[model samples]
Target: MPLPDPWNRDSLVWRIPLAGGAAESDDNPGVDPPEAWVRALAAVALDLRCLRYGREVNVGRLVWDLAVDSEYFVSIGWQGARGVGGFSRGEGLTVDASFGEAAVWVADTVQSELAGYDFVQWPSRGRHLLLPRLLATNPAWVDPHGGRR
Candidate 1:
């Protein structure tokens, strides 16, 4: 069965059964990441002022959906295309550093990475303001080598 849409408040009330007949408990919180990991990621989001977008940005929610073992790298305007769906795995500027190191990297890089792209005068608001830059430089949206797609 499909998991309920996580973004839907009504859907969230439905309790989806755990795989392998596992039970949820404080000692075994199922798929949730450790509190330390969550705090680290939350610190990153806070550093970015992502809370400014409220529910429109998933990073603000401090959800643990990324693969813990994967190497992280920067992704400029990573979530610019998701619209109201907000950030998810593979979104945002990633860092290969440890959580502590990642937090510092984010703090140091966010201002520089997001510089001049604030779209202060753009009519549309929220994270969409970053979309224009994303479209121009994102290889998925443009040919970085200056070749026709």
Candidate 2:
């Protein structure tokens, strides 16, 4: 199956401008989403409070380039203290051992919470906004009132 367009016009994903007078979207070729992992790392990434330049990096446009391009498993990583962010594509579907602490933290956090979810099926519109609501209803990830540590 063709991967879902990460650049869906209606979705929140947008282009980030580079130093030149061009946009990152200019060369980006949207990938066909993997059937096994229906979730957009982008959606979960948006809720993360990680800050950049006194603001949050646009998580909606953060695509797992390695995963989408090579058909491999991918992950997001960051180090708040060091101001570092990274993406990694696993050998197959597993995470690599060389990943840094921040990468591992983000990966572990998201995976643990999404233990049984396949994000590919999430609604195309407002998927980011709805994920918190969905997680709230899941007994494994959230309490009845929808708060968790």
**Which has the greatest TM-score?**
1
Q: Candidate 2 lDDT, tens digit per residue, 1-149?
A: 54433333422222321111211233445633332232333324443432212222333333343222232334332222222243332223322322232233334444443332333221122222122223332212222233442
**Model 1 misplacement above 4 A:** 1-29, 50-65, 70-78, 81-99, 116-149
The lDDT per prediction is 0.31, 0.31
List TM-score per model, in order. 0.30, 0.28
TM-score of 1: 0.30
lDDT of 1 by residue, 28-106 (tens): 2345433333344455444344323322332332222323322322221222322322232223333343455444433
